[model samples]
Target: MHAAGLGKQSLLIPKQPLLLLHGLFGFRELGPFVYFHGITEPLKSLGAKVVATRVHPTDSIANRAAQLQTQLSQVLKQYNTDKVHVIAHSMGGLDARYLINKLDWERNIMSLTTLATPHRGSYIADWSVLNIKQKLKIESLFKVLDIPLLAIDQLTPQYINECFNPEITDVPDVQYKSYGAWKQFESKFSYLYYFGQLLAEREGRNDGLVSMDSARWGQSFNEIPNCDHINIINWSESKFDIMPTYQKILSDLYHLEQQRELKWSIR
Candidate 1:
């Protein structure tokens, strides 16, 4: 029998849709941004709609959050649902938090799953500002990520403490989970690399760019080894195995939803 013949509710279990947002210097199409499609596909197969977002490449967190608010508002209106599940990567994680805390979208979301986000500012950002050659290399490689926006000194630790401390009452109703990645398996860079050294010094275990401590914030945390900063979302590498990590996250999120449902049943 055709799916259409089974009726509207036969195969579709409608819940609030999932939204995917990429990191700085990222687009909806880049290699580092493409693997999310795989994760979303599994979700859609489970009867959810996944919406991927594109934002101005150099916009501030505040501006980006405002833009996402508008976009999410439209998604809610279009689907006739008041909430969404957000999955954000890297700087996009900060942007998501901004949407919840700064823009007051706590009531309009269900949960958040952040992947390899630098909740604590990266020392690499600090190092790059001091070394012009490094800055140029980063700008050349990831041109979309504006250095001015990522300046570590300008981005005081206090900023991180204020925004992502989990102490802040940003989204009182939202449940949060974080995924941290580390470059445990062999990678191109070694500890001698400045960023690697920074990672080692600050986090002890890092994803080549961000440390585990930085990525894992709030109460719930998941950790994945053998993945780097970009590999957490990138699809180009065979060695990275980002798919399994995302699959595990999706499974955990599903379990969380089930737990919530059980709680409601008890109520």
Candidate 2:
């Protein structure tokens, strides 16, 4: 349930490619910085074909999902592989879900594992959509700034509950699992503390950006302790290391893939 019982070790070499999807305003890489820091090298070392995808940094869920689909399609064609294992974080998880369920990618994506994804929705986003007039005014502000704002509006509780979730259902036999990030609010220097405080009153526990309740979407729901939303991606000033957690996820994904394949083997 926590970021224990996990360590760096030789991992199962995946036959199917692994696709890494980033959250809101995420980039595959910027100079030396990467979205999933300390992730790609290890996966490549494990002989896993990894594709860290990039989509529009700030965009609507539909637009983001379309970009994801295009990238994945290109990757699949390039690698000559039909199956892929998707690991998504934050809003990227929503994008993955949309591609898999709404965009007819279920047959290609064998499994989806999300971390700190606001699958149900987030209170912080709801805070923005206080009322119709206010929300519209905010939208107008974004337009004046020449910034697209659908992604923010879509992250609210109302959108996911009444609109997105109702329309998107997990395809049968497509494995879905999710994990949450957990951290104690101790640093006023970090904004996550404030967000966590607000989420605590409404959603129990959170990883600053998304509540544990909101992070849960699929089957397995676990919390990576001592991790905030940013630290889960290994961008932390604290001592909490994220590589072990990622290792655990990759190992579990391999085993799950094997099991699924065995279950459906042409016996």
Candidate 3:
């Protein structure tokens, strides 16, 4: 939700660069269209250095992380930043978590902030997996199209609970933050609305695609009220501005860096 008077708020970012990550079936850009929509350019205009990166649209987390690591290596070379903050949405959050945990990015990464991410996996994935006929058809189509199907299996709640979460433990020094949207539309024609209803039947509150509970992770979790999953990226049906929240997060990162520096000095 876009809060009134958010534009009046002024926030500043430090020297640390920001890396923006997109979710499943996402891309940096397709012609004039962007995955992060209005986020990157606006942040850049504010003097915050940022990288909006792309990964395999549908691939295993390990594969996606490898791709991200390669890009991050280049980004570090170009920017010369000691540490960077990661802002990831949806399935990209899982990829970020994996990169940090298994790939030993604890030293280079200062923080990770996720929006509408399914940290605990989603009911939608579970339902999709259970629906064998449909799943098979879709899998066959993806195979014919040469798209990987392993990523879809990984998003199931069971996989995350039993296999993933245990492996992807968080580092103490790297701060983690999360945000979720719970608002859903009642429109019958919208696919998100339909998924929202499915999730709502058992999950209480959802953001059309992901449940708020599933979205929650890390040391802090914030609610973007009256926002759906896509709305978090500024492309949803609402006109809610997402820049303010992005600015606030960067401001917070700056403060956190100050605190870290002070701690290092004390030691």
TM-score of every candidate relative to the true structure: 0.77, 0.90, 0.93
Q: Which 10 residues in a row give candidate 2 its minimum summed lDDT?
A: 1-10
Segments of candidate 2 deviating more than 4 angstroms: 1-9, 129-141, 144-146
Against the true structure, whose TM-score is highest? Answer: 3
Steric overlap count per candidate: 0, 0, 0
Q: Rate the local accuracy (lDDT) of all candidates.
A: 0.68, 0.83, 0.85
TM-score of 2: 0.90
The true-versus-predicted C-alpha distance at residue 253 of model 1, in Å, is: 2.6
Which tens-of-lDDT digit does each residue in 36-81 have in candidate 3? 8877776776678889989999899999988998888888888987
Q: After superposition, how far is residue 126 of candidate 1 from its true place, in Å?
A: 0.8
Considering every candidate listed, which one attains the maximal lDDT? 3
Candidate 3 has a TM-score of 0.93
Clashes of 3: 0
